[model samples]
Target: MRFTTQRKRFRDLSEQEIIALAISSEEDDAQIYRGYAESLRADYPASARIFDGMASEEDDHRARLIALHQQRFGSTIPLIRREHVAGYYTRRPVWLVENLGLDRIREEAEAMERDAERFYVAAAARTTDADTRRLLGDLAAAEAGHQESASDLANRHLDADTRSNEDATARRQFILTWVQPGLAGLMDGSVSTLAPIFATAFATQDTWTTFLVGVAASVGAGISMGFTEAASDDGELSGRGSPLKRGLASGIMTTVGGLGHALPYLITDFWTATILAFVIVFFELWAIAWIQNRYMETPFFRAAFQVVLGGALVLAAGILIGSG
Candidate 1:
C-alpha cells in the first residue's frame, strides 16, 4: 500500500515530467538494445547490427525529446522515470533479455516498439494541451515507424542465406543446450529406474514400499543428473550455452520421467498398481522414442524398435529376478 501511493499518477504528471519520462525511457531502451547487440555479437553478427541500428534510432529519439524539454522548461529536466508514472509500460531488464535466444530477442524488440506506440497513443488521448497532445501523437507515429525501420534494417543486414544460416545455428544451439541434455536425462531416469522399481514391486508386492522406492529413486536420480550436467562442461568451448539452464532442463526432465511410472504405484491394490506401472512404462518408452525421432533426427521406426527392445529386455530381467 505504501509503495502504491509512492507512484505518481499519469494524469497528475506535468508536461515537463512526461517529456522527462520519455527521455529516460528512450535512454533505457537504447541501453537495452545495445545490451542485446552485445550479447548476440559473437554468434549472430547480422542480428547484432540490426540491434545497433535500433539503438542509434533510439538515441535520435532521446535527443529530440531532450531538445523539446529544454525549449519548454529550461535545461534542468526532472528525474522522472517510467516507474514513477502509474500505468506506464515497463521494460524487462537487460540481463533477463540477454539470456533469451536470438529469435526471442527479436520478438521482444518488436513487442517493445508496439508497447511504446500504444503508450504514446494513450498519453496523447489523456492530455488537454494541444502542444502536449501533438508531441505525444508524433512520438506514437515515430514508434509506429520503428517497425518499418526494423524491417528495412533486417532486409539490409539479414539476407536469405544469412538468415537461414543464423536460424540453423540457433536450432543447433537449442538442441545442444536443452534437448540433448534433457533427452539423455529422460532416457537415464526412465530406463535406469525401471529395473529397481519393478523388481521391488514384484519382490515385495507392497504398494507403499514400491511407491516410496520410486519416489526416492526419482529424486536421487534427478539430483545426481543435475549436478553431473552442470559439472560436465562450462559451455564456453562447446557453445552449449549456460550450464545452469542445461542442468535444470536435465534435472527436471529426469525427475518427470521417473515419476511418470512411479505415480501408478500409488494405487492401493497390488495387481492394479503393477498393471498400471507396466502400462506407464510402455508409454514412457514410446515417448522417448518419439522425442529421439523428432528432435535428434533418428528414424521413427528404428528409434521405436531400439527403445522398445531395450525396455522389454530390462522389464523381463526385473520380472524374472523378482519372481525367482
Candidate 2:
C-alpha cells in the first residue's frame, strides 16, 4: 500500500493543482488556528483572541484564493493537499500542538507561517503565467507579514498583566498535571520501597534475589501509584488536568525512582553492588529534595533534611531487621 500510494512532486503539478493545494493548505491552517483558539479560550482568552484573528485571516486568504481559482480555471477545484505532494511543507496535527505549552503553540504558529511563505515563493517561481505568479508572490508576502500581524494582535489583545496571568495559569496547570503527582510518586517509590529492598538485600545476601525484590517492589508501587492518581482525581473539579497524563507522569516517575538503586544489584560483587546502591539512594533522596524545592516551592535545606532523615531512618530500620 505504501509503495502503491505514491505522492506527486510539487514541481510537476499544474497551476490549477497548485492553487488547489494552496486552498486546502489555507483551509487546514484555518482549522488548526481555530482549534488552538478553542483550546486556549478557557484559560488564556487573550491568546485565544489572537488565534481567532489569525484563523480569520486564513479564511480570508482561502476565500480570495478560491475566487481566483473560479475566475481563472473553473468552479470545481481539484482536492489536492499537502499530503498529496512529495516534499511539501506539513503542519503538525492540531491535537499534538494544542497539548503543548502556550509559548510552544505560538512558536508553532510562527513556523506554520514561515512554511507557507516558503511554499508560496517556490510556487510563484515555478509559475509560467504572469497573473498566477503575481498572485503567489502576493500570498508569499502576506504570509511573511503574518508575524507582525500576530504581534499587533497580541499587543491589542494580550496586555502585559493579562499575558502574565495567563502564563501563570499555564505554569500552575503544568505543575498540577505533571510535577506534583510525579514528585509524590517519585518520593513514594524511592522512600517506601527502601526498607523492603534493603532488608531483602541484607537478609538474603543474594544479588539476584535483591534485584528481583527491588524490581517487583518498583513495578508494583508504580502500578498502584498510577491507578490511584488516575482514579482519585477526574480533574474537572480539582483542575489538576487530564487524569491519564497525571497517571502516566506518576507511573513513569515512580518506576524510575525505585529503579535508580535497584539496577546496581546487577553487579556480581556483593559489597560493590551494595555500596553503589547506597550511593544511588543518597542521590535519589537529594533529587527528591531538589524537585520539592524547585516545583513545590519548599525551602531547599528543609526539604533535604526531611527527605534524607526519613530515608535514613527507614534504611536503618531495614538494616536492623536484616541483621537480627
Candidate 3:
C-alpha cells in the first residue's frame, strides 16, 4: 500500500515542474521554427521571412517566461518535459514532419500558437502564486495574439510578387524531393527490368523462367539504384534530404515500377503473359507521364510524348539486344 502511494506521488508533477516543461517546450519550438526559416532562406525567401518573424516572437515569449520564472522561483529552473505528464502531446522533429506545403506549414504555425496559448492558460490556472499566475496569464494572451501577428507578418513580408515566387519555389522543391527521384526510379525499373524478363521469355519460352528472371532483375535493380542514388549526392546543393533516405525511397519505387509489368509473366500461358506484360508496360508509361505532368508541371501531351518515346526506344533496344 505504501509503495503504491509513493509510486503515485512520483508520477505526479508540481506546478513548478509543469512551468519548467512549458518553458523547455517553447524553447524547442522556437529553435525548430528558426531551423525551418534557415532552410528556406534561399528558395522560399518570403516564407523564410515569415518564419523568421515567428521565431523572433517565440524567442520573446521564452525571454518573458524565463524572467517571470526567475522572479517567482530562482535563477535556476529544473528540467521537465511533456513526457513527464501522464497525457501530453508529443513534439515531432521538424525534419520528420510530413506535408511541408506552404499552406501546411502555415497551419502548423497556427497550431503552435494555439498549443502555446492553451499550455500557458492551463499553467496559470494551476499556479497559486499571484505573480506566477499573472505572468502565465500574460503569456497566454500573448500566445493567443500570435495567430494574427503571424498573419500580419506574412502580409508584410509576402507581397504578391514574393508569394508567387515562393509558390514557384515550393513547386520546384516538391519536384526535386519526390517527383525527380520517383521518376528516375520508375524509368530505371520499367526500362532496366525489361531486358532480363524478355530475354528469359525468348530464350526458354517458359513463363515461370521469365517471371523468375523479371523478379530477380527488379529486386537487384532496386537495391542497386537505391544505393547509387543515396551515394550520388550529399544533398549540399540539392536540399532533398539524407542520401540514404532518399535513395531508399527512390530504389523501392523503382523496383515496384519495374515489377508491375514483370509480374504478369507469372501466368503460365505464353500468350496471356505477353498480353498482360504489354498492358502493364502501357499503364506504367502512362503513370510516369501523369506524374511528370502533375508534379513536375510538364504539359500532359509533352510528358506523354516523352515517356512513350523513351519507353519505346528502350523496348526496341532490349528486343534487338536479346535477339543479337
What does candidate 3's lDDT look like per residue over 109-214, in tens digits?
Answer: 7787888788778867877778668767977888887777898998999899888887877777666766788789998898777767776776677898888888
Ranking according to TM-score, highest score first: 1, 2, 3
Candidate 1: worst-modelled 10 consecutive residues by lDDT: 1-10
Task: Give the candidate order by descending lDDT.
Answer: 2, 1, 3
Tens digits of per-residue lDDT, candidate 1, 1-324, equal 364567899888888888898899999989999999999999999999999999999999899989988888999999998888778999988788777688999999999999999999998998899978998899899899888899999999999999999999999999999999999889888888888788888899898898899889898999999999999999999889899989998998888888888888889999998898889888899999999999999999999999988888887887887777
- Candidate 2, overall lDDT? 0.90
lDDT of 3 at 249: 74
The total of clashing pairs for model 2 equals 0
lDDT of 2 by residue, 1-324 (tens): 366558998768877887898899889999999999999999998999999999998898899889989999989999998989998898899889898789899999999998889988998898788967887898899898776788889999988899899989999999999999999999989998888888988898888898999999999999999999999999999999999999988988898889888889998788899999999999999999999999889999999999999999999988888767
TM-score against truth, every candidate: 0.97, 0.95, 0.76
Global Cα RMSD, each model = 1.3, 1.8, 4.6
Clashing pairs in 2: none
- Could you tell which candidate, 1 or 2, scores higher by TM-score? 1
